[model samples]
Target chain A: MRGTMLYAPFDIRFQELPDPVILEPTDAIIRTVATCVCGSDLWSYRGITPFTEPHPMGHEYVGVVEEIGADVTGIQPGQFVIGSFATSDNTCPNCRNGAQSRCIHGNFMSTCQATSIRIPLADGTLVPTPDQPSPGLIPSLLTLSDVMGTGWYAAVAAQVVRGGTAVVVGDGAVGLCGVLAARELGASRIIAMSRHEARQKLALEFGATDIVSERGDDGVEAVRELTKGIGADSVLECVGTAESMKQAVRCTRAGGSLGYVGVPHGVELNGEQLFRALIGVRGGPAPVRRFLPDLITRVLEGRINPGKVFDMTLPLDQVAEAYAAMDQRRAIKVLLQP
Target chain B: MRGTMLYAPFDIRFQELPDPVILEPTDAIIRTVATCVCGSDLWSYRGITPFTEPHPMGHEYVGVVEEIGADVTGIQPGQFVIGSFATSDNTCPNCRNGAQSRCIHGNFMSTCQATSIRIPLADGTLVPTPDQPSPGLIPSLLTLSDVMGTGWYAAVAAQVVRGGTAVVVGDGAVGLCGVLAARELGASRIIAMSRHEARQKLALEFGATDIVSERGDDGVEAVRELTKGIGADSVLECVGTAESMKQAVRCTRAGGSLGYVGVPHGVELNGEQLFRALIGVRGGPAPVRRFLPDLITRVLEGRINPGKVFDMTLPLDQVAEAYAAMDQRRAIKVLLQP
Candidate 1:
């Protein structure tokens, strides 16, 4: 089997690797049908998050089950499926509470950029499509593995409601999806904060009612002005930088909420500021599994097409190009064919 | 008029001061019915929160309207009222959103300790009781001005629901009130974290089903053990220190919420820690005005008795002794009469 590995900063290698097999009774091996590079992948690829050893990369994929462990139930071979970037047994206390990302028996998936991947907790982690999806739907379905679901979680966490306003503080793929999620959740006003023309256009297409190109205090003022000086009822922070979090917090109205999904790098929140602003904050890795079923249905019903986030597509062997293109801002996201 | 003044640390003096008069059309002068020493007053009393000059002290009060400016409406002279520590123009955006503490036109009341208090936004700030209450009900009704309302806000912010579990961190007047609030909200298992035997007894009387005397990590461990190792569904942080905030965070289950009513001092939250725990945090000065009507009704109906927290009583002239009792931890809370 062939897979992608990061040898060092700015170095991605797609080469021959041993095929995956069930290592535990709860595991299943799936043959990758499609995979993709994520914005988070750039963290290690840029060496911002250093690594001592070369490691397998990628956490998003749509695949076809090849074999299942003896103890695996509710899942069978030859089925097409989509799974969360984080694996969960789905019955633990946290999972039952809709926080599968924090499930006691969970592990983040890090080796999905391969021909064949071994998935633990298969019965609980993977949700099968009613039938094998057509090629066109594959891209959209693949997004359900992380970005789209994360965006949905962001909207849910922000407590976005019908007839309310929302502010999305990032223009990345996830942020674009968040615009769609907020719209679906019935936010009457969706503001997308973006300076890039192309991303701004995509945001509008994804249901953004307004766009603010300014950054920092100016951006906060713009949002406040748009919200009648009260700020948005909900704000989705798709970037984990301190600046983005601060902007998101300032964009939310008193009694409003900010939902942050981006992995934090060096973000610190002041208790006093949050208290004075009366903002409710909830953030973390997206509990993708919790939203997988509903999102999958939404995609299959053709109600959403999040695959539009994939601006570029490449062969799985060109995995290096995928990382480089996203790193250089040449691609919003790259879908990979395995 | 006479008022309590804090000249410096440990230098509280009851002295003659200028009588308060209406300065705004919306202002209403109230004769003090009852005012009390608050835990927060000790911050400045202890010189932890410094003041540049001698200042009038106190924020909690249940008073009778003595005079009203021309524009004041809905409240009449001689009407008994219980108002929030923070006055608000309830028509403001924040107030309409149920966060009156952050109202656009609002101010924290600091002159209530005096014989006469000038309240801004009189029509919006004060809620009249059904009628003048008997002396026995005054203390309980007075609590709606701050402590009891704050505890109610903590439970409300934590999203307490019937049959859920709650953990109250801090055994001060507000925390004891939180135990009562949790019970009123229908929490099946209310855990009160208190090291003081007297406070523990009061908490149990307020409907706490369990008490954990441990502090810090040991306290968190004890809460976890009682909660089936999942932590409580809602945790109230009534102490503002960083340690209390951290303990409150750890005691909440993944996807649970922490409502911190404590006015934070030097508290900084690491975004990464909160992200990994999937904890939702919301805190601030309680919007007591929002809860005044409901709480007052509860007291009038004899459904609640928060006045028990005031174990000691003093004449208004003994304001200095009231502060001393609370400062020395000799009284849970002290009620004052003019």
Candidate 2:
């Protein structure tokens, strides 16, 4: 199987790798139908997140089960399935509490950029489609594996209330999807903060009622002005930078909630500042597995088209191009057909 | 008028001061019926919080309105009233969102330890009892002004679900009140963290079902052990130190909520740590005014006795002694009869 590997910063390569096999009784092997590069993956690709050696890339996928371990239940060979970045038992205390991403027995699905990948805890991680999804629905289903689920988690974490205003801080794919999530959650006003024309257009298409083109304090001021000087009722932070985090908090009204799903890179919160700001703060690795069922339903019902976030698609061997497109912002998100 | 003045660290003095008068049309003057020294006040008295010149002390008070400015409405002179440490207009966006403590036109009340104190935003800050309260009910009513209100805010911010377990970090008056608030909010189990026997007794009486005396790492371990390694569902962080904050966050299960109402000192959060912890964090200065009406009703009905936290009482002129007792931990709280 050909897989994507990052040996060093800006060094994405497509190389032949051993095909995956069910290694554990609860594991299942899936032949990838679709996978994608993520904003977080760029952290390492851009040399920001450190790595000592090359490793398989990609954590999002929608595929068909090719083989199943003897102990695997509910999932069967030939079934089209969607699974989150991490496999969770879904029965642990944390999982039961809706934090399946932090499941004690979970492991990140790091080899999904390959033709075949093995997923552990298959019974808890894989959600099969009602039928074999058409290729047109594949990208949206793939997003349920991570990014779309993550955006939904951000909206949920922010406690987006009906008729309330919600602000999304980042203009990346996740942020655009957040606009969709906030809209689906019943926010009457969705404000997307984006500087790029293409991304801004996508944001609006995803249900953003307003856009703030400024950055830093000016950006916060813009959000405040838009919210009539009180700040948005719910702020979604889809960027992981310190400045983005600060602006997200500043753009939230006192007693409002902020859901930050971006993997923090350089973010730091001053205790006094956060305390005085008086906004609820929550977000982390999204429990994507938990939302898979609902998101699949939404996609199947044609209620949402989250896959619109993928602006570019490439064959598995063109993995480097996919990474480059995302890194250079040429694509909001890039899909790979394996 | 006479007042307690903090001349310097450990140098409290009884001094004659000009009587307070309405300086704003929205102000109202009140003669102190009961005032208390707060745990936060000790920060300045101990030189932890800076102050170069002598200043009037005390922010919690229950008093009788002596006079009202022309603009003051709804509250009449001679009414028994409870007011929080801060006065808010309660009409601003923040106040409308239930964060009255951060109201746009808010100001902290600092002359409450004196015989007479002027409260700004009288209509929004003061909540009057049905009638003149008997002397026995005054102390409990006084707690509504700050400590008890703050505790209630902590419980609310933590989102204590009925029948869930709540862990209160810190055993001070506010923490003890947190136990009571959790119980009132329908928490089936309340764990009070304290090393002091007397405070522990108060905690138990206030509805704590268990007490964990361990501090720091051991404390977090104890909580996890108690919860079968999952940690508490709701954790009230009543202490604001970095260690306490970290322990509070650690003792909370993934996806749990942590309400921290402490006046933070030297606390900072590594963004990655908080992002990974997956706990909802919310709290700041308690919006006491928001809870005033309900709390007053509870106190008047004799459903709770939060004033038991005030173990000692002194005449207004003995303010120095009152500060000393609380500063030295000789009293959980001290009431001043002005």
Candidate 3:
């Protein structure tokens, strides 16, 4: 099997690797149907998130089951399926609470960039589509494995409600999906913060009702101006930097909620500031498995087109180019055919 | 008029001060019916929160309207009322959103220990009782001004629901009140973390089904054990120190909620930890005004008895002793009468 690995900063390699097989009774091997690079992948590739040694990359994929462990009964070979970036048994206390990302028996999927991958907790992790999806729906269905699911969790965590106003603070693929999620959740007004023309256009298409290009304090002022000085009822912090988190907090009105899905990299929140603002904050790795079923339905039914976030697509063998394009800001996201 | 002044650390003095008079059209001067020493007052009293000059002390009070400015319409002179420690216009965006403590036209009351207090936004800040209460009910009604209301807010913020499990992290007056609040909200298992025998007894009386005398890591472990190793569904953080906040977070289950009502001092939260835990946190000064009406009804009907938290009583002139008792931990809370 072939797979992508991160050798060093700015270094990605597409090389032959050992084939995956069922290692446990609850494991299954899947032949990758489609896979993609993620914004988080850039964290290690840029040396921002240091790594001591090279490792397999990618956590998003749509695949067809190739083999199943003896104990896996809910799914079978030849079935098309999707799973969360984080694998969960789905019956643990945390999973039952809708926090599958924190499931005691769960681990994040990191080798999905390979042509074939082994999935643990197979019966609990993967959800099969109604049927083998057509090629046109593959990209959108692939998103359900991570980005789209994360965006849905963000809107849910922010408590976005019908007639409420929403502010999305990042313009990346996940942020764009968040705009769609907020709209689907019935947020009456959606504000997309971005300075990029192309992303802004996509945000508008995803249901953003307003756009504020300014950053920092100026950006907060713009949101306030648009909200009658009340700020937004719900703000999604998709960028995990200290600046973005602070801006998101300031953009939320008192008694409003903030849902942050960005993996933090030195974000320290002041207890005093949050207290004074009376903002409810909930964030973390999204429990993607919790939303996978509904999101898959949404995509197959053509209610959403999150695949539009994939501005570029390439053969799986050109995985290096996909990473480079996204790193250089030449592509919002790249869908790779396996 | 006479008032309590904190000239410096450990120097609370009851002395003559200028009488408060209405300075705004929406202001009302109230003669002190009752006021009390708060745990927070000790922050400045202990020099932990410094003051540049001697200032009138106290923010909790149940008073009778003595005079009203020309524009004050809803409240009348001689009416007995209870206002939040933080006054709000109630009509402001934040107040309308149920966060009156962050009202656009709001200010924290600081001179309520004096004979008279000029309450800004009188019509919005003060809630009149159904009628003048008997002396026996005064203490319970007085708690609606701060401590009890704060406890109610903590439970409310933590999203306490029927059959949910709740953990109270402090055993102070507010924490004891939180036990009651959790019970009122229908939590099936209410755990109060405290080592103080007196406080534990009071907590049990307030409907705490369990008491964990341990602190720090052991305390979290105990809560986990009580909660089937999943931690409590809702945690009330009544102590503002970093340690207490951290303990509260650790005691909450993944996807559970925490409401911290403590006025934080030097507390900084690592975003990464909170994110990983998926613990939703919301805290601030309690918007007591928002709960005043319901709490008043509870007290009037004898459904709650939060005033029991005030174990000691003192004449207004003995304000210095009241502070000493609370500071020495000799009294859970002290009620002062004018």
Candidate 4:
């Protein structure tokens, strides 16, 4: 089977890798219908996160079940499914609490961007939408796999109250979607911190009421001024950069909450400051599995169009171009049709 | 008026000071009926926390309202009240949300140790018992002012779950009461780290399931081991020392919550570690005013007896020895009568 293999630093190759097979009783093989590149993927692509092992890349995907293990339940062949980057046993205590991504049995799904992929914990991790989704719904449903769920986690973790202000720190797809999420959660105001016009415009479309084109303390101050000196009641930090995390922390009002979903690089928390202000901080990789069902319904209902974050789309043969475009800022997110 | 004042390190003197009057429209002059030394006072008495300015020192008090300003509503003169150290309006958003300590108009009682003290925000800050309590209930009621509230805040902040493990990282009155708070919050397992005999015994009575004599990482490892390889679901960090903070962080489970009410002397948060672990940290000075009503109800109903933390008592003239005994670790918590 032809697949994308990450060999080493700045190295990705289109090579013939053996097709994935069901090695466990809960495993199932799915033919990838759609796969995409993620910002976290860019970390390794930029060589900042060095890969020591040669492995198949990509974790986000929408697909059709091709085969299933004898014990695989609920998920059947010919079903269209979307799964999170991480696989989880949906029945674990953590999973039952709507944090499947932190399920005690949660593990990284193998290379999902490929002609065929194997998934474990099929019943618990995968959400099968309708047998067929409208062409208009593909983009939005695609976003549910990772970006949308990640954004929703940020908004939820921040405890974004209805009729309250929320600040989003990051211009990435997750950040923009966080704006949409804050709005969905009933936040009356959403502030996006970004200078780029394209990103800012998308943020506005997603539901941001204000934009602070500043960084660090200045960004915090701008948000504070906009929120009438009380600062944001909730802040969603989607940019994994340290500076964005700092801004997120500084921009939250005393006794407010900060929901950070970005894969933090070097962000530091000043305990004294957080303690004195009484602000709460909570976040992690999105528990996409927990959110996939409602998101799928909302997307199918055409209530949300989060797929707009995918500015560029390509086929399997042009996967390299998709990576390059996203890495060079030519695209916000790249979708690959396999 | 004769009142207690701390001139400097090891110098708590009873001297003549101005009789507190209603300085604000909402102010009330409370005749100090019962006041107590706090664990935090030891920090000042031992000079670990320097007295930047000379002032009265006690913040834990249950008093009789001697007089009230004309504008002070809800509270009448001659009522016995058990109020928090910090007075709050209780009508602001923060106060309404059960964070009265962070009320917009609240003030920390940094200098409330005297015999006759003025209280601001009289309406929202003071809660009167159904009837003036007997002497035995006075000490227990006084604990509601700070230490008890701090412990309750820690437990609540930690999100202690029923039939789940909780690690308490301090052994002061607040820490011991945190063990109680965790129990009240339904934590099935409470592990208190302490070497002191009295506090540890009280912690057990308060429902601490285990005790860790070790400090720092060793204590954290012990907690993790007790939780069957995962750390505690909730951790109540009552001490603000850097060591306690580290233990608090280290002992919490991944995706777990830490309720830290410790007043950090000088502490920092490692954002990189915190973000990756997805730990939730929340706390500040206990919203004592918010919890006062409920705490008073519990004490009146005999559901909780927090006065056990106070092992020694002295008259107002002997307040100096009260501070000295607490500083020398000869008492868990001390009570002073005026």
Candidate 5:
């Protein structure tokens, strides 16, 4: 199997690797149908996150089951499926509570941007599509594995109440999807904080009612002004930088909730500030599996087009180009067809 | 008028002070019906929190309106009312959203442990009782000013679902009130963390189904064991210390919510830990005004007895003793007749 590996910062390569096979009764091997580069991937690609040794790349994928373990149930070979970035038994107390990402036996889906891979806890982690999706739907189905679900989780965590205003910080793929999720959740007004034209356009298409082309305190002021000085009722923080977090917290109205899914980087929340803000804070890794069924239903029903986030798509051999495009901000996301 | 003043750590005195008079058109002067020592008061009284000047010592009180400013409309002279420890306009964005403590025009109700105190934003901050209550109801009504309401806020913030399990840290008066609040909110099983015999007894009486005397890691393990290793569905963090906060977070199941009403002291949360735990954290100064009306009705109907927390009482002139009793933990709470 040809897999993507990050040997060092900016040193991504496609190399031959052994094909994955079921190692446990709960595992299944799947042939990758689609995969993509994530914003967080850039953290390592840009050397911001230390990459000590060669590491397998990609955790998000839409795949077709190639073989199933003896104990696996509900999923079978030849079925198109969506699996979360992390594998979970889905029956643990945490998984049952809709926090599969924190599952006791959870493991990251490593080396997944390849032709084939083994998924542990197949029965609990994989959700099959109604049928083999068309190529057009593959890109969107791939997103359901992580980005889309993350945005949905963000909206839910933020308590984006129906008929309320929702502000999404960060114009990355996740943030764009948040606008869509906020809209799907019935936020009457969606505010996207973006300075980039392409991302801003995508955000508007994804249901952003307003776009504030500013950052930091200025951005907070812009959001406050939009909501008549009260700030948004719900805020989705897609960027985990300290500044973005501060902006997210500041732009939320008193008692409003903020869902942060960007994975905090150097973010330190002052207790006094949070106490005074009285904001309800809830977010972490997206429990993508929890929202899969509903989101899959929505996608199949033609209610949303989350796949629009994939601005570029390349053949499996062009994995390096996919990484470069996203690395240089040339693409919001790059879908890889394997 | 006479009020309790903290001259220094462990140095409390009943000092003569000028009688409060309306200083704003929205102000009302209330003659103290009942006042009590709060757990937070010990922060300064024990010198854990610095006491620089001779500060007026009380904030919690239930009283009768003795005089009102021209603009005060909802409250009238001679009306028994429940006023939050902090005054708020209640019409501001924050107050309208149920965070009256963060109201744009909010102000702490200082110098309240006196014969009379002035309350600003009277119409918005005061909730009149159905009628003048019996002397027995005064203590419970006094709790509405802070502690009881704070506990109620904690439960609400934790989103205690009907028939869910609730774990409360900190067995002080507020935590005891949280047990009562959890029961009122329909939690089927309430766990109270307490080592003190008196606090444990009060907790059981207030509807705690279990008590865990262990603190820190052991306490978390105890809660986990009680919940069949899943942890509590809702946890109330009533103590602001770092250890208490950590225990509260650790004892909560993934996806469970925690409401921390204790003003955080020496508490710093690592984003990674919280993110991995995937617990929802929300709290601050309780928006007591929001819950005032409901709590008042419950107290008036003989449905609850939050006043039972007051195990001792002292005359206004014995203010020093009132502070001493609470400071020494000799009394769960001490009510003052002013």
Candidate 6:
């Protein structure tokens, strides 16, 4: 099988890799249906998140089970399923509490940007579609594995509820999906802070009632203005930069909640000012598995098509072009069909 | 009536301030039976929090209602009561949602520390005690007005529960009380991170199962070791410093909650890193009024005496000494009597 591997900065390549197998009774092998490049992958791609030898390079995927371990209880071969960017034993205390991403034995999925892959704790990590999803819904279903699920968790963590105001910072795929999730969670007002016209339109389509085409201080002011000078009732910080985080806090009301799902870069949380500001801050690596099932349903029901975030698509062999599109900001998320 | 006034960093004076009267239709006048300096007050005295011209400083008090406005409905004159540090109308959405400290028209009562003080929104702010409280319970009951209530809120915000482990990251009255609060909340293991013998002893007496004398990184390690390499299920951050906040975040389990009530000092929140960290953070100024009624009952019934935090007592005239002792770290909290 061939998979994407990165040996160093700007060194991504698709090369032959050993085929995967069921290493344990709880492991299962899946033939990749669709995979996508994530914004987080770019960090390591740029060599900021350092590494060693070439390693498997993807974490998001939707596919049909090619083989199932004997211990796998709920899933079988040929069943379409959406698995999270990370694997979790859903029975753990943390997993049971809706924090599957932080489960005691949580494992990052072996990069799924390959023809074939092995998933551990298959019964706990994979959620099968009630029925085989049609090929047209493949891309949308694949998104529920990571970006879409993450956006949903951001909305939930921020506690955005019916009739409340929700603000999302960052124009990435996660942010756009957050706009949809906030609306689905019943937020009466959804504000998307973005600059790209295409992204803005998508945000609006996904339920953003307002848009702030500014960043940093100006962005905070713009959000406050839209919120009647009180700031947003909930803020989803989807960009990991320090500036974006600061903007997230500044744009939230005194007692509002800030749900953050960004892969932080150069961010520093100072305790004193944050405590005085009085906003509750939550969110870590999202429990994507927690939302995958419901998100898949939403995709199947045609309530949303989050895969529209992938403006460009390519064959698995065109992985390099996919990376370039996302890196250059020409695309939000680039999908690959294996 | 005489009251203690903070004139400068080190200058506190006893002055014959004007007698307080019911200034608003919802206000009442109370004759204080007991009053004490708050942990926040010492911040100014220690030159950490800025000093303003003649800041009338006390915020914690328990007393008998001397008079009530015609419209005051829930409370009446002659009632023994304890109120929150910040008075709330308790009718706004914020208050209705249990965040009384952020009430729409809330007022901090630190400015009215005199023997006779006017309580705003008296019907909503004050909590009734029995007609008579045992003399021995006065100190503890007085604590319910702020310190104990604040501590309890911290514990509650941290989500402490039965069969769980908790860590308190401050040694002030609030943090010490958090140890008591954690126990009362049914936390199975209570860890008080304190180096001071006085506070440490009090923590143990208040049900702390262990004490970590270290701070920051070392302290986090100790807590992890105690919790079998995982961390406390909850962490109560009661100190406003950056270091303490970091410890609160560091000592919590991956999915555990950190409830904080520390007045933030220069702290900044990094959304990205925090998103990857083990804990979830929530909390702000304690809604003491919301918890005071129940705490006052416990105090009156001899269930707790959190006022042991006031190690020294002084006449109103010794206001300078009272501030000096607490500011210099010689006392936990100072009791000022008229």
Candidates arranged by DockQ, highest first: 1, 3, 2, 5, 4, 6
| Better model by DockQ: candidate 1 vs candidate 3 | 1
Interface RMSD of each: 0.9, 1.1, 0.9, 2.2, 1.4, 3.0
Q: Which residue runs does candidate 4 get wrong by more than 4 Å?
A: A7-11, A52-55, A92-98, B91-93, B161-164, B212-214
- Our model 5 lands, by Cα RMSD against the true structure, at 1.2
Per-residue lDDT for B1-338 in model 6, tens only? 88877777777778888788778899998898888877788778777777557778788887899999989998878888888888899887667667688787987888545688888999889888758676777789888878898899889878899988999999999999999999999999999999999899999999999999998788999999999777888999898776777778788887778888888776555445467753678877888877876887777677888878889988767878877788788999888776
Model 5 chain B: ten consecutive residues of lowest lDDT: B268-277
Top DockQ prediction, candidate number:
1
lDDT of 6 by residue, A37-101 (tens): 99999988888898888877999998889999889988989898889888998998778767788
Q: Over the stretch B139-253, how does candidate 5's per-residue lDDT look in tens digits?
A: 8999999999999999999999899999999988899999999999999999999999999999999999999999988888899999989899999999998888889989889
Candidate 4 residue A179 C-alpha distance from true site, Å: 1.7
Ranked by DockQ, the better of candidates 3 and 4 is 3
Q: Give me the TM-scores for chain A across all models, comma-separated.
A: 0.99, 0.99, 0.99, 0.97, 0.99, 0.98
lDDT of 1 by residue, A1-338 (tens): 99999999999999999988789999999999999999999999999998999999999999999999998987889999999999999999999988899889999999999998999999889999989998999999999999999999999989999999999999999999999999999999999999999899999999999999999999999999999999999999999999899999999999899999988889998889999988999999999999999999999999999999999999999999999999999999999998
| Per-model lDDT | 0.94, 0.91, 0.94, 0.85, 0.90, 0.85
TM-score per prediction, in order, is 0.99, 0.99, 0.98, 0.93, 0.98, 0.87
What value does the TM-score of chain B take for model 5?
A: 0.98
Q: How many backbone clashes does candidate 1 have?
A: 0
Minimum summed lDDT over a 10-residue window in model 6 chain B is located at: B269-278
Cα shift from native, residue A332, model 6 (Å): 3.1
By summed lDDT, the worst window of 10 consecutive residues in model 6 chain A runs over A269-278
Question: Which pairs of residues collide in model 1?
Answer: none
DockQ of predicted candidate 1 = 0.87
Runs off by more than 4 Å, candidate 3 = none
> What tens-digit string does per-residue lDDT give for candidate 2 at B168-228?
9998899999999999999998999999999999999999998999988898888888888
How accurate locally is residue B63 in candidate 6, as Cα lDDT from 0 to 100? 84
Interface RMSD of 6: 3.0
Write down the C-alpha DockQ for each prediction.
0.87, 0.81, 0.85, 0.57, 0.73, 0.47
